[model samples]
Target: MGRKKKKFILGIDLGGTKILMGLFDRKFGLKKTVKLEMDGNRGEKFFFNKLIDGIEEVLEETGSDLSDLVTIGIGCPGIIDIYTGTVKVSSNVSFFKNYPLAEKLKAKLRVPVFIENDANAALFGEQQFGAARGHGEVVGVFLGTGIGGALIINGHLYRGVSGGAGEIGQTFLSIPSVSDFETTRLKVGALVGRNAIASEAGFLLLRQKCPHLLEEIGYNVKKIRSGALSRAIRAGDTALEDLIRSRSRWLGVALANVVNVLNPELVLLGGGMMEAMGKIILPEVRSGIEACALKPLMKALKVVPSRLKDNAVILGASKMACEILKMTQK
Candidate 1:
C-alpha cells in the first residue's frame, strides 16, 4: 500500500554526542534546524522522548504541523540494516544494541521512516550536491568519535553483501611499536578515532606535563574536542601537534591501502574534526598517501575536504526522503 502525501519532511543526524535535526518543506528546502546535545547513557526511553519533543518543538517554532510531515530520514552511526531499518551495533550509542529504529519512530508519528548509516547519507549528500558532485568513484573518510567511511562506485553507493560496505574503519593496519623490532596491528577506528586523540592528549599532559593541555582540557579527556586540540596546537603545543600529525599520517596510510585496492578518483576527509583541523591535518594526510599510494592512482586522485561538513548528513537524509517521495509519486 502506498502512503499518502504530506507537505513536509524531516531529517535527523544522530551522532555519538550530538543530535542535529532539520525541517524541510515539500520542495526539500530547509525551513528550520535545531541542534541538541546528546548523551547516549541517558537510556533509550529518555532519548526517544527527547527526539519526539525535539520534532514537535521544531514544528511549533516554524508554525508547521505534524499532519503535514510526510517522511522522516535519520542518519545514525554504526551498522544499519537498511533493508529493515534496524540499527545494529552502534558502539557510539551505548543503549542501541539492535533496535528497529525506523519502525518505532514511524509507529509514533504515523509517517514513513527510513534509516541509513550516517556516513552513507553524508556521502550521498556530497555526491548529489556537495564536494563529490559528478564523481563516479569516491571514498569518504569521516573522523569523529570514530572513523566512518563510505564508498561510491560507478555513481552509486556500494553496500556490501550485508549492507555494510565501504567501511574502512574496521580495516586492520600494522603500526610501528615502541620496540623497533615489533609492530602493532589495530583497526583504523580504534587507532585514529577522536577518543584516541583525546587519550593521547591526556597522556601528553601526564608525561610532558604540558600546562596548556591542562588549561585546554582540564583533565577530562572528553573535553579535548577538535577545536580545543587545534587551539592548543596553534598556541605552540609542538609535541601535541606532532602527535596529531602522526595520527593523521596513520590515517593517510590507511587511505593509501584503500586507494591501492579501490583506485577511487576522489577521497574526501571530513566530519567535525576535519572542520576544525583541516588546515593542519589535510596536508599531513595527503603527504602520507603520497608516501604510500601507487604513482598512477595518485596522479588522478583528488583529495578534498567535505564541503557540507556536519550539514551533510541531515541534508542528505532529507534528500533521501525526497527521492523516495518522488518515486512514490511516479
Candidate 2:
C-alpha cells in the first residue's frame, strides 16, 4: 500500500485590530504563520479579501496548496452562534454584525470551517496545551480593545443557553446615574477595557503627568496600545502605574464576583494588557480577588497568567478543526 498523503489545518485569530493565521500539520505542529493589520476600516469586502489573500500567502510560503487542507477554524471576537458559525454581534468588529463567516469562508475555500467565540477558543487552547492544562474547570478573561471571557467545566467548553453563558465582560459593576430616573447601566468592558485605560492615560497627559509616554504615543489616545503603555510603566512612569493599579482594582473586584459565583479550579488572566503588564497588574487583581472571594474557595482556587501568549487562539482553533474532521470521518 502507498503512504497516505498529508493534510493540514488552518487556524485564524480574527481580532479588532489584526488578523493572525497559522498553518498546522495533521499532528498539530505549527508550520507557518502570517500576520495582518486590521484597523477596522474599508468595510467587509476589504476584510474578506485580505483574509483570503493571507490564507493563500501562508500556504504558498509553506510549499503547499489549498488541496492539502483538511479544515479551517476561526476564533473571532463578539457573540458567535457556534452551530451556524455566524457572528451575532461584534462591537469591536463593526462590519461583522450577523456575519455568516464560516458559511462564507466554506463557499470560497471549498473546505470545512468552524467558528467559536475568540475567548472560548483561547480558553480551550490553554486547557489543552497551555497554562490551564490538567485543570478541568477554569475561567478565562481577556482584556483588550474590549473584554472577552469564557468558561470550561469538567474539561469541556461550556457555552450556556444561546452561547452567552460566560460573557463576563458584559456584567455590570455599577448602577448608572440616569438623568430622568430611568434605569441605566455600564458594563465592565467600558469600565476596564483598553479604550478606558487609554482614556485614563489621556487624562494624565492632559494634566502633563507622563511626558515620556507623550513622546511614545503623541497626542493620539488610540496609539497607546497595551505594549506601549507597558513600556511607559517600565520607564518609571509611576503616575501611569498608579492609574493602571486603580483600573486593575476594578477588574479584580469583578473577577472576585465571578469567582464567588462560579468557583472554578483556576482563573486565567490574559489578552494584550495582561500579556504586556501581567506582573504589574496581577498583584492588584489578586488583591481584589482576596477582598471579595469566598474564604474557603480561595484556599482551593488558583489564578495565574496564560502561558501561550499570542498563540492560544490559533492553536485552539486548529485543534477544533482536527476534532471536526474526526467527527466527519465517523
Which of the numbered candidates is closest to the native, going by highest lDDT? 2
lDDT of 2 at 319: 91
Q: Write the residue-wise lDDT of candidate 2 on 96-155 in tens digits.
A: 888898999999999889999889989989988999999988999988888899999888
Candidate-wise lDDT, in order: 0.86, 0.87
TM-score attained by model 1: 0.92
lDDT of 2 at 17: 86
Q: Give one digit per residue, the lDDT tens place, for model 1 in 198-281.
A: 887889888765567678667788788888888888888888888888999999999999999999999998898899889878
